[model samples]
Target: MRDVLVIGGGIIGLLTARELRLSGAEVTLIEMGQTGRESSWAGGGIISPLYPWRAPEPITALSRWSQTVYPALTTQLLDETGIDPEFTINGMLVLDDEDLDQALDWGARHGQPIEILQEPAPHAIEPELGPRPARALLLPGIAQLRPPRLSKAVRRALEKRIDLREREEVCELLVADGRVCGVRTPKGQVEAKRVVICAGAWTAKLLEQLGTPPDIQPVRGQMLLFHAKPGQINHITLHAGRYAIPRRDGRVLFGSTLEHAGFVKRTTAEDKEALYNDAIELFPVLRRTPIEDHWSGLRPGSPSGIPYIGAYPGIEGLYFNAGHFRNGLVMGPASARLMVDLMLDREPILNPAPYALNASR
Candidate 1:
């Protein structure tokens, strides 16, 4: 029997296979489509877990821990596979004073070098933003990664021996004699000793087949990207209104409207216009840039805005690591680590209390 069967090809599933394989376990990863094309690939790729006022503690902790591993991790992947995740620190800026205060407090408490700047700091693409006001908090270490690149590298690294089964859609968790023994897929039955469901927005649907979907639904997000003035905005600047995330390359990812509509992955004209209007306001020079593309992804959102990790209460050997919402790209590595540690050996880096599947109970 394979030591582990990861039933999704997103960041968490790929990372879990990596972690478990590091522990010398035979792992196989299954994906219904090309790897990392889901919400994991569709995110803005923000690295900082620090929200302005409120953020979940367990998830935030995991993000911080993952940030430490990213440097060595991405570099090693690049060296081995010649695929750069494009990990770069572009700094995150806060515009609102109220939000900035919350950021300062939390950052100081957590050893984050969130700087409070009085004067406008030197930034790339200053002309596009068109004379923004001063008062900004700069998180020097916060950054971004190319999600598609990381996903490709991880797939390449794991596909050799991890039994990567793409285009294999998992239909149900096969429970026999009160234990998760395998999974039912469209192609055939995958027999395994254990199963890990990492099915992002589709997690609830899969779990419902097992009779325990944990109140997770699709929170649709609309995003727009532009090949704007090269180096117009270098830092990740955020306000209560919108966010502008600039990559090491010339592209600027402006985005993401949080809507509670269920399972709608289609883009809308209004959301597109809204993003552009907000982007130009943040940096006015964007008026000249062509709208490169627009897209949407359905993030798995829970009521409390937290992901459920660890084992399912009723099913033995059944595990869930879904419902990450917006933090998937930022915080998936550490969460996957915690999951592997807990499920493989029943020991985790931090107390897994808050993120327990039954935490609300």
Candidate 2:
């Protein structure tokens, strides 16, 4: 029996399994499909929440901690696995002025430096921006990573250290004497001392029979990728819930629409056209550039966009670390660390009460 059985291979699960292994626990990670091919691979990889001030404090805390440690974590991953996640601090420019006051106040309270740029200033920061807003907020410390690359890097690092089971779906939890003993997969039952559910959008379904499961549902988001020249857009540009992320290699990721489509991961032409129009409105250069790819992923949406991360009620040795919504990539590391800490009985990095499964109850 392994010390831990992670029931998903997304970013959260990969990171959690890695953390558990680092803490000297034998870990086995099983995925329904190929690892990192779901939401983790499809996200824009923004290291911070879209609007830090607008999110709940728990999300802020997790993102803040994750942002701080990202550099070190990526560096270590590069050193060990020879893959660069391309963690870049290119900053983020908010073109919407509706939340300026709240944003400033939240920045002040959180000690995050935010600059209000006016006129040519916003244009000066991002020359590719078209029809700029009168005022904009600049989060200079914001960063982004290539999600596919990061996922690959983390998987590469974990492949050698932990038992990674790809293409194996965990259909049911095996319980004995009122305790979770293992899980049932298509192949066979694998026993474990503890089980952690990091199944992303599928988390709630897995826990439905257990009890009052976390309010997690699949929120579908479709994105379009544009191939542009390097340095065309210097920062992440956001307006009206849509954003453009410029990668290190001249590829810009323009996304996304939050649709309650219920586990449907198919991309649509209508959404692609809408997203293209929005992207061009933000960065006019994209009008001429070709869209390299279009895809969709289902985010694990929860109430208030807060993820549930703690032990399961009435089920010993069962735990949860899912429901991150759109911020899973940003909150992955800290969420994993916190889950591991609670599981191993170590001092957690932040208050675990807010993320507990019973917090809402």
Candidate 3:
């Protein structure tokens, strides 16, 4: 039997397969579509969730671990494959103050470098900003990486290292005597000692057949991209439930309407206009720049905004690392590492109790 079979080819599956392979396990990864073309590619690529201090403790822990390791990991990927993921530490600027008190206390408790800014600091930090915000928080440790480049780099690096299959969809899990043995696809049944479901938004469809589906639903997010000269925006500027992420290549990404649209990845004109309005509110100069792209993807939303990332309940040799919602890019690294630790029976970097498949919702 093959050592491991990873279903789905988003950032989570790719990284998990890479981790297992590095531990000397023979791994095979199957993707329904092209690798990294799902939610991972459609994301804004900010390494931290906007207003992270208010997030769940599990989310914070995984994101912090990912933030700590992303630099050296990206450097190694770039060295191995001639692809630069453009990992940048430009920081994050939160312009909303609705939850400022709670966020500040959380940051202080966690020892995060969250600075409360008054007038002039916002404009001084990012001159392109139209006006000073009512209240601001400067998270200097926050960073970002180009998601497409990072996905491509990892896929490229694993070309010869693992058995990567594309256009192969897993139809069902092969179970025998209450234990997962392999998976069934349209092509054939591939035998593996273990199976992992990293199918993102479609994970529910697969898990339901096994009678252990988690409460994962699809949340659609639409984004607009604008091309401007570099340095137009120095940091990831966020305000009023929207954000503008500027890539190093002069591309400013403005996103994202959170709608429970059920696998519909359509970008609407209304959302586009709304996103444009939000973007120009922060940087009025962007009003003059033409929008370059508009697109949408489905994020796997779990209960309480935390992903299910451990052994599948009541099933042996079946695992899961899906339902990360909008934080997939931010939590991918640590989530993958934790899954490897669980499958190998080793202690994880952080406590795994909070992220178990059957953890309290």
TM-score of each: 0.95, 0.98, 0.98
Q: Where is model 3 more than 4 Å wrong at Cα?
A: none
**Best lDDT among the predictions, by candidate number:** 2
* Candidate 3 colliding pairs, count: 0
Q: What's the lDDT for residue 275 in model 3? A: 90
Off by over 4 Å in 1: 50-53, 120-127, 131-133
Record all residue pairs in model 1 with backbone atoms less than 3 Å apart, i.e. clashing.
124-232, 125-232, 128-283, 128-284, 128-285, 129-283, 129-284
What is candidate 1's lDDT per residue for 213-252, written digit by digit as tens? 7777888888888886557777788876577888777888
lDDT of 1 at 168: 88
Error of 1 at 120 (Å): 4.2
**Model 3: per-residue lDDT, tens digit, 1-361?**
8999999899999999989989999999999999999999999999998879778999999998988899999999999998999999888999887788898898888778888888777888888898755568899988899999999999998979888989998887999997999988899999999999999999999999877798899999999999888988899988888898889988999988999988878989898898998889889999999899999999999987899999998888999999998899889999999999999999888899988877896
Ranking by lDDT: 2, 3, 1
The worst-scoring run of ten residues by lDDT in candidate 1 lies at: 120-129
Clashes of 2: 0
Candidate 1, TM-score vs. the true structure?
0.95
- Scored by CA lDDT, what does every candidate get? 0.80, 0.92, 0.90
Please provide, for model 2 over 1-361, each residue's C-alpha lDDT reduced to its tens digit, 9 standing for 90 to 100: 9999999999999999989999999999999999999999989999999878989999999999999899999999999999999999999999988978899999999888999998989988788789966899999999999888888999999998898999999888998887999999889999999999999999999888776778999999999988898989899988989999999889999999989989878999999999999999888889999989999999999998899999998889999999999999899999999999999999999999999977862
